[model samples]
Target chain A: MKDTNDWKQICSEYLANVDAALVNATVEEKQQILNDITIHLNERYHELSDEEQTWEHYQQILTDLGPVEDYAELLNEKSPDKKKFQKHRKAFWILLCAGIGCVSVLACSIGFFSHSAIKKARESKRPVVVKTFPAALDRTVDPDTTEITVTFDQPMMNFSWSWVGGGEHFPETTGQPRYDKERTTCTLPVKLKPGHWYWVGINSEKFVYFQTAKHIPAKPYAILFATADKNGNPTEIPIDYIEETKRVNSK
Target chain B: MNFNNWKIQLRKGLLELVVLKLLSSGQFYGYEMVKTLKTIKGFSIREGNIYPILARLKTDKLVVIEQQVSPDGPVRNSYAITEAGRLMLEKMTAHWKDVIETIDTLTAGDTK
Candidate 1:
């Protein structure tokens, strides 16, 4: 028959004492005692007719005799001295891994902001600096020729830009020039096939360091920057044609 | 004789051996086995408990089982030890004797 109160109450109250006292009893004797208790409770429970009274009587009996869990604790007096310590270390490792992940995310955010701050300082001293430019840009692709533009953190003025070098392999060295109030705003349009690549650079040639997109030259190209003082003295930053590097698909 | 709780004073672990030695003698039904077993004062046990052991021994082929119709209109399976069981019984007997001798030697004055 189903029990009204959970077995835990029985285990908690009487199991330990019973197990200790009855350790010498045969298996059958122990089973018979448990069986007796079950039958006794069943009879009282059915006779009471009142569910609450039945429940109370059952619990009263159980609260008097503890269960196997209590007895097992006594039996385990010989168990480990290391299990407790191992439990602590295992908990620590889980917490440590969680801490590392949090630290990594924080470090990544700090690194990103620090790099941005350095870039701003570098840009402040220069009249103009180029961030990126086209690789060996193709010289002719009808409309396939991609435009190479220079980007700056701030605006620049009084400058002209030109690109040269259109050769089958350096023979058709065609050159063109363009002008704008701002070099950062100047866009150089060129025509090139997809396979024909070219390189171009931006240089104000003063107070600012110039960087070009150095990559495998599809078809070698260069940019000329002419920034001058109060006079019309052109300081030419010779956009020399660098040879194309072979494209290695590292991936 | 505190009746020494047959369970408590029955030479520690020799209760099963005592049972085995009895079974080695001849075939007997559950009630008969218990009746005979109780004759040895401290060896009293629930007769039903032997049924499970008998079932186990029969399955192990350590004991053979044969059923006879009882007046109750039901069959009673009697148990008799097989050759292997008898051999096991001999070994158990020898082992128990050695155990007692060793225990006596070790316990010395503690022997009752």
Candidate 2:
């Protein structure tokens, strides 16, 4: 029981691919081509019987239309605008490469003096753990706490991070790690169980993902905490959890 | 040359003529024209291939589009041949007949 919206979505997805392929066509030409194809598809869809108006039939119509790129090729074949666009694109790339060449030469000359400065800065700027959400070794964190955040002493590389330790003691991550706009703090979304102990290593010796923009690795730090039960009472650590931690640390 | 490639080239050349001929009968939307063309032997075409030809024909003033409202659905862009298109089709049809006659005469002995 697919609705008109579903049909429209399918057609839109196909048209988007076709639109991307019509790179050489002018904006007006692309619009005209897309409009014509949309009208064509709409007409064909309406012509179908109630029973034939299924997703399969809708897909078959596109199959009959053939590959989308072929339409781009056919439309671009005799277009005078395509020739003009190609010429402009060629000139644009030539100028872009020349500009990049000049910039590279300038960067190389400046880099001679900047290299030692950067090295000195890197040696002095090893990132430190400035703050943590659970305050490191707290014994009574809320089990319902959904995230753990760590702030750095300096702006770190936003794309790279490592919440290293594994096994049962490692918090179960619910989502990807994200960095604050300043790139100084990173948050890891996690799911914690009541009365369970958790420990996560930020950039261990083997996995040095936590690094500054200059590629200086952060000093290894550990986060350890135990969540309180529903009654707000501390519970004994499970034997299996301790065994798993030992097995993970041994590796 | 490959037979399929030969037919593809032949079909590409004949598409505008065939589309013009279809429009000469009556105003038809893009999809209707494609459906009608697909029924003819040796003229089977991908539905997408017709739009560029139609676009070219419209640009050349050989054919024009009229927006017509359908009772059951959205407004449809229907194509109809112009006076110029008819003149062009007439010449094309005549030339096509001459070519067919020449080919028939050339291959007459092969049929036997």
Candidate 3:
């Protein structure tokens, strides 16, 4: 007859060994384990036959193991493999974040320098641009069509024109509207609906100077008019690749 | 009932019994087991934990599994108690009751 203390130790050993055994304890072995424990408990219980009642106390402890296997399964949920995966995942994220930070810093540095260069360029290009289109003022037109005339500070090559307003009221015309290897006087024909508003945006491929890095034409790209004013004067409207203003009179 | 020991283990264990009792009632898929167990306080379970023991029980054949298709995907075979499982539950429960009564009677200090 094992003492209650011994029975207690046995139960503890069983719990501790249970996981190891469960790693591969056949049902028979587990059941045998359970039986051995019971026999141990009962043998103790009977030894205290004079106090058979004391044996009853261990019965609960004995029955409880049945349910514990279920609970042990619960604790196993946060398995080591899963934990390792989470650690690897965390490291991967750290590396990814570092990569992103590196790219961001590189981009920011490039942007800062490029912006500085662009600002300097504008400062330098502004004077040259002004010299080319010194008469960057609106010329009023009254009917039939608007005539846009440009004078360059120097002879320019490769002149292009594109119409950007009033839907089909005035379709954009492109493909080297006209080129002047001499006076650098560039002009384009803009056809528009009378009594409608429109803008003719022009672009030239000439570098503001004979030696400049940029060839972008200036803004408000030569405003034109498709609409006739109250006095029949042409009223200019800005247009681009955006939708046309319902050609109030594409006629 | 030691506040910090065996009785605590027993209190925590009551839930396991309820789950086993339920499995004894009929086959229950893991989720189904959880749904049933939730109502009983100690038995509230983390779903993942149930499978390993069920697996062990399966190896033990004290509990057997029956696989069935489910829209949620391949469902684990549900657990059902075996005759040996029934016997075990019966014997353990008998021991559980005997112990409880003995404790009650002894702790009450009423030999009668």
Candidate 4:
């Protein structure tokens, strides 16, 4: 039925010896030769019970078959010698292809990063003005309490201040610009005269243009608002705009 | 004479010829052929050794192999003699008879 431990050990040792001796035989021929021997052993072993199939009997059988080296010589005679070199070259090609695959992946990664860095550099060179507070045009507000705050998509550098039509009619005072930790939001503390309309603009051409911490330049953007009367609480109402802020383009 | 060595030499000369003649009657696998030949005293051979000779016969086109299901439900290699094998066996048999007859005549004259 099943091969005994001794039988299996004998067969394994014999096949290993045969394989070592068969240097010039193809792998397929070696396997077939081993299969034939194994089948012969199995057929003989099955003719007797496990108790009667001794290692001595198996040894005698192997001896009667003659030396395994002789068998290997016969197998080599039947197989071609050129296939050994082909198998060696085939292994080398697999290693070479694996190396090429790794290099291709590394090159693609470098290319992708270079493209991204170039794109980021181009975008950073152009300034963008995002939003302004008190976004009103010709509207009423309490100027004394109104604070102008601007939010940019990215952080900006602190710039010098200038206002048109605000010094004479409005309070002639300007406070330092306070920025958040991100520096994206800038608060301009200005004291204005009540019930007056003012057109305010900030840009590098007329005022001082700001650059980001990374040294990207910013352009001019404006807000228009009208102050509230003395008895009016402009903070109680939302600031409505008659004209929306327009896109800021490079000068 | 060392019995083992004598048997080895004897079988080496006549084994293939005898195997092909046995198969000329009907197909027989390695184990079956060994069992049949074991009936003759001093003709014993390891079943393992039969396969190589069978392979050689097949290479020489004297035998063809087939598979048959054994009673134990396992497939076994069955060897049958080809037309070429029968013709070769016939010639070998005639030559074997001549050699035996000549040897017998010489021995009989020596006894006289």
Give the proportion of true interface contacts each model preserves, from 0 to 1. Answer: 0.00, 0.56, 0.06, 0.19
Candidate 3, DockQ to 2 decimals?
0.04
lDDT by residue for model 3 over A1-251, one digit each (tens)?
Answer: 33567456445543443433243343443453343333333433443544444423443333333333333333333444446656777898999999988886898777754556677776554312222221222223444543445554444323122223334434343211332435255555444445554444343232121211133334224333444555776455554412332221121
Candidate 2 pairs with clashing backbones? none
- For candidate 3, the lDDT comes to 0.46
lDDT string for model 1 (A16-129, tens) is 334333343334434433333343334334455444554345544443222222222222222132345456768988999899878867877777545566766654554333
- Clash count, one per candidate: 27, 0, 6, 3
Chain A TM-scores for all candidates read 0.24, 0.47, 0.32, 0.39
Give, for candidate 3 chain A, the lowest lDDT window spanning 10 residues: A204-213
- Kindly list the per-residue Cα lDDT of model 3 for residues B10-111, writing each as its tens digit: 544554456567888888866566556657665434332344545445554577766565695443446689998788778778978998999998988975
Which predicted model would earn the best lDDT? 2
Worst 10 residues of 2 chain B by lDDT: B1-10
lDDT tens digits by residue: candidate 2, B1-112: 3455576678888988999999999998888888889899867788888987887677668988888887977777788999999999999999999999999998996888
Q: How many backbone clashes are present in model 1?
A: 27
All candidates in order of TM-score, best leading = 2, 4, 3, 1
- Of the two candidates 1 and 3, the one with more favorable lDDT, higher being better, is 3
Highest TM-score, which number? 2
TM-score of each: 0.29, 0.51, 0.30, 0.44
- The DockQ figures for the candidates are 0.01, 0.21, 0.04, 0.07
- Cα lDDT tens digits, model 4, A1-251, are 34488677666655665555455555544554566677666776666776668765766555555455445334333412345556786998999999978886887777754546676786666555577766635356656654677677776543212332343433333444555546577767677777666556655354333555444456666666667767663422223323333433223
Best by DockQ: 2
Q: Over 4 Å off in model 2, which ranges? A: A3-5, A79-251
Runs in model 4 lying further than 4 Å from the true structure: A1-3, A18-33, A53-251, B1-7, B69-72
